[model samples]
Target: MSILITGANRGIGHALSRAWQSSGTEVIQTARNSPGMEPLDVADPSSIKELAERLEGQPISTLVCNAGVSLDKFDELETGYAPELWAESFAVNVTGVFLVIQALLPNLRASRDAGIAPKIAIIASQMGSQNSPAGNRFIYRASKAAAINLGRNLAVDLESDGIAVGIYHPGWVATDMGGDSADLTLDEAVPGLRKQIDELTLSETGCFKSWDGSDCEF
Candidate 1:
């Protein structure tokens, strides 16, 4: 089976790609500017279109929307989280995910036509959960909230076409974004994430899950 992963140059995405490759899965990795990565700027419509055109007839078994930014991590509550940051965050974290899926919808359909279940795995966060109460980094939280919502809606809308969408929290891994104090390592997270992605099905299209297959709130 073939898989397409965004932001696969580093962090959980990189780990996931390596794991998939090691398992003999055909993996198509994309990044905006990373060395040796196929050019794909998810925030740019033109770039997304170009990539879509380049992979025109290729059937994508899974599309993992892992390209995201955490611009609000350093923003302070009293004097940060600026207006521009909000736009930038949503542009990459939310809109980018939608645009990639929209541009490659046909490829996903091709996978279904080939009798390979087409799936969309969105790397969202528990930070987006309304059930959990947190204070700072409003932009990241809100954008992630939007992402999970988008994944849920896309799952419903695309179900008739046999596309399955699942949103996930990859866990707090020790990556640049997750930081050194994170709860998991890149090694610890990739396996469960791959399992979650592999098991995605039409019956559970809108499911929100953790990397370990537990249900995620909201």
Candidate 2:
């Protein structure tokens, strides 16, 4: 199967790319930097369009939207807080993901004939849950909340096309964003996430799930 992952230069995205590659899967990895497995700036509309053009004829069975940014310092609402930080977070976390998925829709659609289960996985966070109490992560929470809604809507819209869309919380992984005190390593998280992706069916689309495959509240 062919897979495309954004922000594959590091952390969970990097680990996912490596895990899939080791398993002999055709992996198309993208990041903003030149050293990426493939070049893609998810935040840039022109860059996303270019990536789509470059991958025009390739089949993408899975599209993983893993690129995101967190303005952790802005946990508390303060006067004179940089509004640009919030905008930047949303640009990368929400708008970026949507643009990439929109650009790759054709590649995903083509996978239907290949007998592959075309899926879209958005890396979301439990902090985004409206059903849960809000934590200090104001910007991160808002971005992820938007992301979850996007995934839910996409699931409904793509169901008729036989495409599945879901969100996953990687459970405080030890990435730069997740910090050193995190509960899981990239090694532990990626494998479980891949397994969860492999097992997903149409019934699970629109659900928010943890890395271990448990359902999460919206």
TM-score top scorer: 1
Q: Name the regions of candidate 1 deviating beyond 4 angstroms.
A: none
lDDT against true structure, model 2: 0.89
lDDT of each: 0.94, 0.89
- Please provide TM-scores, in order, for all candidate models, with all chains considered together: 0.98, 0.95
Write one digit per residue (lDDT tens) for candidate 2, span 129-175.
99996557778888999999999999999999999998999888999
Q: Write model 1 residue lDDT over 87-183, tens digit each, in one string.
A: 8899999999999999999999999999998999999999999899688879999999999999999998999999999999999999999999999
